[model samples]
Structures are given as C-alpha cells and as structure tokens.
Target: MTSIALITGASGGIGRGLARQLSAQGLRVAAVGRDVDRLADVEATLRIVADTTTPEGAALALETCVRELGAAPTQLAHCVGTTLIAPLHRTRPDVYRELIRVNLDSAVYMLQAWLAALKGAPGSAVFASSVVARIGVANHEAIAAAKGGVEALVRSAAATYAAQGVRINAVAPGMTETPMTAGLLNLPAVREGAGRQYPLGGVQTADQVADVLNWLLGDGASRLTGQIIAVDGGFTTVRPLVK
Candidate 1:
C-alpha cells in the first residue's frame, strides 16, 4: 500500500511548505484547509477544503483523504493555529475562546480524527506549538494558554497511543516569519527586537520549521514520541541577555 500524508491548514506558510516537501518525497499529500483557491496552489495530490477545527470537519477531511488516496494517511501535520498578544485581564472572552478554538481545539479534534482513521496502524502526528507556551511571555496570555493546552494534549495523547504504535510530537518555535506574525515583523524595530531575543539572532522561516516537522512525521523519528521540540533559536532554553 502507498503511504499518504495529510496536512491541515495547508494554505498557511508552514503548512504549504510542508505539503510541498512531502509531495516532493512522492507521498500522496492531502492538503486540508478552508480556502479552496489557496489550497490549489499547494503541491499536494489532494486539496481538501474543511475546517478541521470542528469534529465533523476533521472527520470529513480524513475520510475524504482515505477515500481519495486509497489508504489512510500514515503521516499527519497540523499547522492550524492563531496568535494573540494580549494580557489576560485585558483580553476579551471571545478572543480567548477563538484562540483556543483555532490553536488548541483544532489539534485535539484533528488528532482524534487521525487516530480513528488509522485503526491500530502505526502513524505519526506533529503539531505547531509556540515558545510562549513554554516560557512566560507577557501580553501573550491568551495565546500561551491555548498552546499550553496543545502541549499538554500532545504529551497525554502520545502516552495514550504510544503502545499502539502511534507517535505524537510538537515543535514550539520562537517568532517565525509567517503571515500570522507579519504585522509584528513588518516594522524594522520590532523585527530586530524580536530577533535579538533569540540566541541565534534571527526569525525562523516557515520552510525552516517545516523541515523539523517533516522529520517528526517520518520514519527517522520512529523512536520519538510525546516530545515538544523547540525550534526557537535557543529562545526557550538559552539566555541571550547580552544585546
């Protein structure tokens, strides 16, 4: 049987990059997203339009991929998330809920759907997390809370399915150059300040993060599970205090 890969939020920077790389590797890639037009631009064998944040939508996307690809996806990459920069007290309830829905809830639903479709077959899943989820980043309470839940879910689900041959992992990246962070990085001052926080002294690109994620979903990472790999430029682990 042919191996298939499914990527959610495929229209986004990281997702699009991942889809292209995976497709280049000759795995039948199913790119799932809400935008039909944008998805068409992705290098995927199948472009599926679905929310994947809702249970029904997630299920539908997986089912559609299995039907179209002639096999369940052996690899899953969930790049669906949103960012928010606001302190808790000042954060509105609706905004928090939306962040949770898009960032955390989407991962939960998509993972569940992926596992259900696998039906005991071995597979792997990788999720997009944030460095803020690991450290205390002021004005990022809402986004932190949402991504924190995602990290927790990753660990718990990884433990739950490891014995069944399913591996789950996440990558918590520092400020990345994606559309979600465009507004912050568009300003030269803000971009330089953000880059300085990382010990590596630069913002990561979507393709850079996607490279790590691709490994997590492949056979090389077969022994890895329940691990949150930080793709940040030592922002989470090092103190680049000297500026």
Candidate 2:
C-alpha cells in the first residue's frame, strides 16, 4: 500500500514546503488548511479545507483524507500555529484563547483524530513548536504558554503510544522566515537584531525547518520519539561572545 502523509496548516510557509517535499517523495499527501485559494498552490495528492483548531474540523479532515487516499495517513505533520507576541499584562483574554486554540488545541484535536484513524498501525507524527517553549522570551507569554502546552502534549502522547509503535516528536524553530514572522522580520532593525541574537548569526527558513520535520516522519527517525529537536541556529542552546 502507498504511504499517505497528512500535513496541517498547508497554506503556510512550513506546511507548504512540507507538502511539496513529501509529494516529491511520492507519498500520497493530504494538505489540510482553511484557505482553499492558498492551498491550491500546494502540491499534494489531496488538499483538505478544514479548521484544525476545532475537533469537528480535525475529524473531517482525517475522514476526507481517508476517503481520498483509501487509508489512514502513516505520517502526520501538524504545522498549524500562531506567532503572537504579547506579555501577559498586555494580552487580552480573547487573544490568549485564540493562541491556545490555534497553537495547542489544534494539535490536540488533529492528533486525536490521526491516532484514531491509524488504529494499531505504526505511524509517525511531528508537531511544530518554538524556542519560546524552552526559554523565557519577553513579550511572548501568550505564544510561549500555548507552545509549552504543545511540548507537553507531544511528550505525553509519545509515551502513551510508544508501546503501540507510534512515534511523536516536535521541532522547535527560532525566528523562522515564515509569513507568521514576517511582521517582525519586515523591520530591518528588528530583523538584524533577531539574527544577531542567534549564536549562528542568522534566522532560519521554513524549508530548513521542514527538512528536520520530514526526517522525523520517515524511517530514518524510526528510533526517535518524544523528542523536541531545536532548529534555531543555536539560539536556544548557545551564547555568542559580545563584540
């Protein structure tokens, strides 16, 4: 049987890149997102229009993929997330709720549906996390909290399904050059400052991060599980010398 790969948030930078790469590898890909027009540009076997933030939508996406692909996805990449920058003091309740829904809740629901569809078959899943979840970043309380929940969920879910031969992992990228971070990077000063903050001296790109994620979802990472790989240009682990 042909392996099927499902990617959420396929309309976004990371998601679109993953879709193209997976499709290139000949896997029957299902690209899931809310925007039909944007999803049209992604090269996948099936483009599923659904809101992954909701349980119903997540289930529908999986169901549709199964109907089209004739089997449950053997690989899952959840790229849905929000890049909200706000300290708790200035963060509104609604914004926090939306952050949680998009960054955390969406993964929860999507994983629930994905696992259910897989039954007892072995599968691999990757979630998109961030540097804020590992360290303290100012003005990122809302996004950090939400992604922190995602990390927790990845570990717990990995533990829960490990014995069943299901692998779950996450990749936490630092200041990637995606549409989600365009607002911050568009400012030359902010972009330069952000690049300097990374020990490697530059921000990462969506395709760069997607490369790590694609490995985690393939046989090459068969022994890996419950791990959060940081693709942050050493930002999360190193401290460069001051000039």
Candidate 3:
C-alpha cells in the first residue's frame, strides 16, 4: 500500500520541491495550492486548490483530498507562508495581520482541518518555519512574529497528538535560494554579502530543505517529535564576523 502525503502550497518553492521528493519516495502526493495551473503540473496523484488562509478553505481542501484520494493522508506538510519585510516602526498593522494569517493561521487551520484524518492514519505533520523563529533579523518583524507562533504551535501539536500517534515537527531554514529570493540573488553585492555571512559560504536550496522535510515525514524520523530542525547551511551556528 502506498502512503499518502498532503502538502499545502505545493505550487512552488519548498512546497513544490517537497511534493516532488515525496512522490519520488513512492508516497502518493496530494498537492494543494492556490494556483490550479501550477498545482496541476506537480505530478502528484491529486491536486487541490484552496486559499488555506481561512478556516473554510482549509476544511474544503481537506474534504476534497480525503474524498478523492480514498485514504487519509499518512503525512501532512504545511508549507504555505507569506513574508512582509519591514522594520517594526515602519511595518503597518495590516501587514502584520496578513503575515500572521498566511504563516501562522494557515498552519493552524490546515492542521485542525486534517487532524482527524492524520490521527486516524497515524501520520506525521511538518510545518515550514524560519530561522527567524530563533534568531532576529533586520526588516523581519512581521514574518518573525508569525513563524515564532508556528514554532510554538508545532510543540503544542506534538504534545497534544502524541497519544494519537501523530508526530509533529518543524523545519526552520535560513536564506534559501528560491524564486522568492531570485531578485536578491540577482544583485551581485547582496548575493556576495549573504554568501560570505554563512559559514557554508552560500545559501541553501529548496531541494536541501525538502530533503529534511521528507525525512521528517518518513519512517526514519518516527521517533522524533516537537523538534525544530534548522536547515540553514550553518547560518544559525556561525558568526563569520566574530571569527
């Protein structure tokens, strides 16, 4: 029997990478995203289109997946997020609200909507957090706050669902190379500065992050829960300037 995995925000970036990796691992993937066209191209067994930022949208997405897939997902990965970079003083309240809704609220809604199916399947659930959850960065007020909430939620979900055999964890990545960061990487100075700042001398790729996520959802990480793994290319542990 093939294990089923449901991934939110599967249209692009880390989410899309994870969907591809999971499918390659022989897990049937249910790719969910707001872009139907992009989701359709994911090469998964099923595609679901939903905003995921609202309770109703999440519920409908979960319902559609369960009804169409013929089995509860054995793994759930919430990879949908939004970033609003601005100094605290300059950040608007609406920006904060939207970031929270996208990063934190979506995770909560997706987990809650599929909690039953996940528990029934004895699954593992992973959330995409950021290194900002533990470290501070300039112009990261909104996203940091939202991801911090995600970290806390991961711990709570792990604890609350342990008895039900559902494992919950998070992956916190640092400056990754994706379409979202393509513009920054295009600037030679910015790219060089970012590269020099990491002990590994460069940013991570979406495939690297996706690899960790795949491990967490697979049987290899069956004993892990409530853990926050940092796939940061040593950025979290190194202080190049200090060295």
Best by lDDT: 2
Q: Look at candidate 1 and give me any clashing residue pairs.
A: none
* Candidate 3: residue 27 Cα off by (Å): 1.2
Candidate 2 global TM-score? 0.98
Instruction: Give lDDT tens digits, candidate 2, residues 62-155.
Output: 9999998899998999999988776799998998999999999999999999999998999999999999999999999889999999999999
TM-scores, one per candidate:
0.98, 0.98, 0.96
Task: Point out the worst 10-residue segment of candidate 2 by lDDT.
Answer: 82-91
Task: Return the candidate ranking by TM-score, descending.
Answer: 2, 1, 3
Q: Is candidate 1 or candidate 3 better by TM-score?
A: 1
lDDT of 3: 0.88
Residue-wise C-alpha lDDT for candidate 3, range 48-153, written one tens digit per residue: 9898999999988888888998878878989998776678999888878888999999999999988955646578999999988778888888899899999999
TM-score-wise, the better of 2 and 3 is: 2
lDDT of each: 0.92, 0.93, 0.88
What is the alpha-carbon lDDT for the whole of candidate 2?
A: 0.93
Error of 1 at 99 (Å): 0.7
How many angstroms is residue 41 displaced in model 3 relative to the true structure, after the best TM-score fit?
1.9
